[model samples]
Target: MKSLPRLILDIAEQLPEGEVLRSGRFLHLGSRSAVQRALARLVVEQKLFRVDRGFYVAAVDGRFGRRSPAPTRVVRSLANALGEMIVEHGAHSANKLGLSTQIPVRCIFLSTGRSRELHIGKKVVSIRHAPKWLMALGETGAGDAVRALESLGPLWAADAVPKLHERLPEGEWSALVRARGTYPSWIWNAIQAHMGG
Candidate 1:
């Protein structure tokens, strides 16, 4: 059997620089202790950096020298690793939709799977549990509109009519209109009022 360090190095070579490595992935190669020790040694040697408990990413050399991967990439890898469905949070959606001027200090993602916090370098990323109605939006442009409208709240959802009409595809708009009962009464009312229903 190959030594744990050798096996780990072999695995690392196959992964892109920003990809996250969890100790659980190496169990097939060696005992858990051996896998963890090898990872710890790599961290000490500056070959890998621990992003969170049992989570590491290869240090990629750049113009300044070894640098950590971007937080967004790391988070995406984390979502894939955890087998979670993740989407942009309402605050981010609102900002993207031009409904808000302030940017969130911590990048937040809504997850239908698990809620947890991750640290990528100095940045903190939050995966918050989202309700089914919101998670139903998925990654569609309509999802962005839903999240943006949600963030704006019932009091302000009415203001999003013009923007929603401009950005939402005709089919998605029709879908939202047809499924108005699934959303908050105010949201349904706003759509209904605009559609002259």
Candidate 2:
């Protein structure tokens, strides 16, 4: 019979690139401690990249030799594996919407999952817990507008409405209108004033 480490490696090789591997995935092959030791050994051998506590991903061998997957791709795969919603932070959304001139200094994201940090190579990505209303629109342009408005606050957000109305697609504008009830009174009032309601 193949050893636990060999069996774990065989399974890891079959996973799609950037797919997250957890200790539980290998538990069927051996005891928890044994599986953990096998995983650690694989990481040490450079066969796997440890993303965070209990999370590992196989390294891709490319023309440049070997390298880890892109941070965004890894995060997306992780979100899918954990069944969580992860979206770019409000600061990024605000900048993207031309509602703010300030650029975000860090790679921050808002997530429905618990807040945590993930280290991928030299970069550290932050995932912060956000309120459900803020995430209700998902990753659409309407969602981006919502997050941008929140980041800009009522005063500046009000000023941004005309520009948004001109540039935003009709469908996205309607989405914003539909979600108006979930926003604060001040924000809704600002949107209403600009929208002639």
**TM-score of every prediction relative to native:** 0.84, 0.85
Q: Which stretches in model 1 have alpha-carbon errors above 4 Å?
A: 1-3, 6-10, 44-46, 51-54
Model 2 regions lying over 4 Å from their true place: 1-3, 101-103
- lDDT values, one for every candidate: 0.78, 0.85
Clashing pairs in 1: none
For residues 1-197, what per-residue lDDT tens digits would candidate 1 score against the true structure?
A: 77677778778768876788888988988788878899989877777777777888877779998776776777778778778778888888888777788797778888888688876655677888988878675777777777788888888887787678877789877776666656678877887777788
Give residue 51's lDDT in candidate 2 (0 to 100). 87
Worst 10 residues of 1 by lDDT: 175-184
lDDT of 1: 0.78
Candidate 1 vs. true structure, TM-score: 0.84
- Which candidate comes out best when scored by TM-score? 2
